[model samples]
Target: MIVVTTPTGDIGHQLVEKLLESGASVRVIVRDPSRLSDSIRNRVEIVSGSHADANVVNQAFEGADAVFWLVPADSKADSVTAAYVDFSKPAAQALKACGVKRVVSVSALGRTTPLANQAGYVTASLAMDDLIAATGVNFRALTMPSFMDNTLMQAAVIKAQGTFFSPIDGDLKLPSCATRDIAAVATRLLLDESWTGQEEVAVLGPENISFNDMADIMSDVLGRPIRFQQIPLDAYKARFLQFGYSEAMAHGMTDMADAKNRGLDLGVERSADNTTPTSFRQWCETTLRPAILD
Candidate 1:
């Protein structure tokens, strides 16, 4: 049986669907099994608990042939980096102890970049990837650029204000991939079991596209003109603070945006053979428009 972590998330949900379609007996690690739909909860064997506990993860890893791993973005913690790695260490240890063979992890792009240590989420993600590798499991660390689905976070803003705001430079064609596409690739790799060892799989869309280009696409998808607003770092930090982020977490976003603006977030490492198809326009037209328009 394949064990999936964070199965309720967008990509995780799709991965679970694909695994079920493949007729695999699926096991899932979830904090609360009752929160899942009865359809999912009934079909899959649920090990209800967080991965933070050694015993919890060890039980979840039992008889799990392969595993899907992801560190959810937790900004509420006092030290976000420590919280992620501390939770990850036990899972890694459990996989080693249990002899779980293959692991597919969800991680951010630009992990090896110099400023990643100061870039908040990227830094923590890089550290998590390293910790997972230490287990000597045949691991695939799926490093993807900014997600196309992130636009959904701006759907309300685009509707109400007719604009999307960010500190990223408008001119830089930062790469992006849909979460579904990423999940599809991970599912394929997990099911096939062809590739092995600790490796970084960089996923990029057909081509790089800028934030302004994205806004233009949003205009067509939304059936109205939508502007791209570059909010100042101070203003962005203030906005994040208003959303209840700790000062450190709010400023962490600011630091990441500054790195993205400087093009440091664009780590151009990619794999050619496993290329999955989906352009930003296709993602917007097919996946995004339906959700926003609905």
Candidate 2:
């Protein structure tokens, strides 16, 4: 059995569907089973609880062969470490106790970069990877840059004002990916049992494109002029705080943005093996266009 966590999330839900399509026996740890569609709930073995709970994970991991692990973002987390590493502590223990054979986890890029230690959430995520790796399970950490679907967060604003905002330099080109590609890669890894040992799989997308370039694609795809606005890093943190995020979590986000701006994600060179298929234009057309127009 392959156990999946956060099965209702953007990437997790897609991964679940792909796994089911591949005829994998699936089990999911979810907070609310009702959040799952009737079709999905009927299809998979449901362990209804937070995967972070030791008892829940122990029960979910029992007789499981592999696991898809993702720590849901906690804007109200007291600290970055507590949010990622601490939240994962229970599952790490459960993995050993249950003798799960493999794990595929969602993580951020920047592990090899000099700025990794100062990159806030990225730093914590790398630490979480280490904690899991120490358990000696075959593991793959899907390290990624920003997700293109993140743009949908500003869909309403883009529809009304024709603008989106970020702290990263608009012209500083960097690799970004579609969540569907991430889910596809995760599904492939989870289904294959031959690969062993721990490694970071960098899902760098098809190409590196900047925010300004993305704005151009959005303009063309949505049939309206859209603009990229680089907001102040402090203001970015302030925006998070305004949204009710804890101070530590807000600073963690700000630091992550600052580190990305300073080339944290530039540590890896793109290659065919690590690069995924989706491009900014394709994502803008298929994903962002509908979010803005419809």
Candidate 3:
């Protein structure tokens, strides 16, 4: 059985569907089973609880061949370490106790750069990968840059004002991926059992494109003039704080954006093996257009 955590999330839900399509026996650890469609709940064994719970994961991991692990973002956590590393501690222990063979996890890019240690959430995620790797299970950390679909969060604003914002420079070209591609890659890795040992799989999207380029694509696809706005890092953190995120978590996000701006993600060179197929234009056409227009 292949166990998946956060099965209701954007990437996890897609991964579950792909796994089912591939005829893999699937089990999912979810907080609420009602969030799953009736069709999905019928098809997979459901372990209704947080994967961060020791008993829940231990039960779910029993007799499982591989696992798909993702730590849900906790904006209210006291610190980045608490959000990623500490939350994952229970599952790391469960993996060893249950003897799971393989794990495919969602992580961020920037492990090799000197800025990694100061990259906040990315730093904690890398530490989480290390904690899991120490357990000796065959592990693949799918490291990625920002997701193009994240733009969907500003769909309403874009439709109303024809503008989007971020702390990253509008002209600083950087790789951004689509979550569907990430799910597709995770599905492929979970289905195949031959690969062993721990490694980071960099899922860089087809090419590096800046926010200005993305705005152009959005404008063309959505039939409106959309623009990119670079907000101050303090303003970005303030937005998070306004949403009730703790101070530490807010700083973590600000640090991550700052590190990205400083070339933290540039540590890895793009290659055919690591690059994924989705481009910003294609994503804007298929994903962003609908979110803004419909």
The numbered model that scores best in lDDT is 2
Ranking by TM-score: 2, 3, 1
TM-score of model 3 relative to the true fold?
A: 0.99
TM-score of each: 0.94, 0.99, 0.99
Q: What would the per-residue lDDT of candidate 3 be over residues 1-294, giving only the tens digit for each residue?
A: 999999999999999999999999999999999999987999999998988899999999999999999999898999999999999999999999999999999999999999999998999999999999999999999999999888888888898999999999999999999999999999999999999999999999999889999999888888879999999999999998998999999999999999999998888999999899988888888888877777
lDDT of each: 0.82, 0.95, 0.94
Candidate 1 lands at a TM-score of 0.94
Q: Compared to the true structure, candidate 2 yields what TM-score?
A: 0.99
Arranged by lDDT with the best first, the candidates are: 2, 3, 1
Measured on C-alpha atoms, candidate 2 has an lDDT of 0.95
Model 2 segments beyond 4 Å from truth? none
Clashes of 1: 0
